[model samples]
Target: MKFAQPLWNDLKCQLQDGFILDTSWTNIYLPNAQILGIGKDITAHKQSKQVLNTQIEQEKLMRNIA
Candidate 1:
């Protein structure tokens, strides 16, 4: 039996509603030339991180002004 190694990747997808979707995907290849993939949504996590980063930058600016 021959099998391709499994791989993982992070992808970004854009929706018609103008929302960005972050996904982590895992791909597995089978001996019969079939491939299977699984994806998990991480939009909320990414958005939260962006908010936190902005907050941190604002705090830094305020500190510099002090």
Candidate 2:
């Protein structure tokens, strides 16, 4: 299956440590809104992918060498 690209709407910052994530964020429409964020740590997944890619490239190089 195929899908269109996603819309990019995330703003990056350490908001809570100081404040917009520089005075403070204001959402006047939702005056009582509280924000919560969650994320996954993909270090293991990324390392495994890198190892697999390295092996694939080594095999390709060996084939060309032969």
Candidate 3:
């Protein structure tokens, strides 16, 4: 029997309506050469994090300018 290590990655997938998805996914390979996958939508979380980071950087810059 053989198996592969579980895989974890973020991917962009296009939907039928042309809306793209940002996802966090995991893939598992079984001993029989079959694969199982699970995914979660993370577009909102990623966008929120990016916005927070930009705000933090702006705050830092403002502090420096003061």
Candidate 4:
């Protein structure tokens, strides 16, 4: 059996903050089956770090002047 393509894509990228995942499989004499998973890209973390660094630098400059 084949599943929908968009549904599969969505499943692969559905990671959210503080969400836990559990996996299970059943064997019922089926021919074949597949499970899909998704996760966030590392770029998201990098971008967040850049924003935080900018905020910290701004705070530091403000303190030095005052």
Best by TM-score: 3
Task: Report, for every candidate in turn, its global Cα lDDT versus the true structure.
Answer: 0.86, 0.51, 0.89, 0.51
Q: Assess the local accuracy of residue 23 in candidate 4 as a C-alpha lDDT between 0 and 100.
A: 27
Q: Candidate 4: where is the Cα deviation over 4 Å?
A: 1-40
* Tens-digit lDDT string for candidate 4 (1-66): 773433211122224785443322222333356543444345455558889999999999999999
Candidate 4 yields a Cα-based lDDT of 0.51
Give per-residue lDDT, candidate 3, residue 38. 85
The per-residue C-alpha lDDT of model 2 at residue 31 equals 28
Predicted candidate 1 versus true structure: per-residue lDDT over 10-60, tens digit per residue: 899888998888988997766678877888898798889999999999999
TM-score of each predicted structure versus truth: 0.64, 0.47, 0.76, 0.39
Candidate closest to the true structure, highest lDDT: 3
Tens-place lDDT digits, model 3, residues 1-63:
555566779999899999998998998776689877989999999899999999999999999
Clashes of each: 0, 1, 0, 1
Query: How far is 32's C-alpha from truth in model 2 (Å)?
Result: 7.3
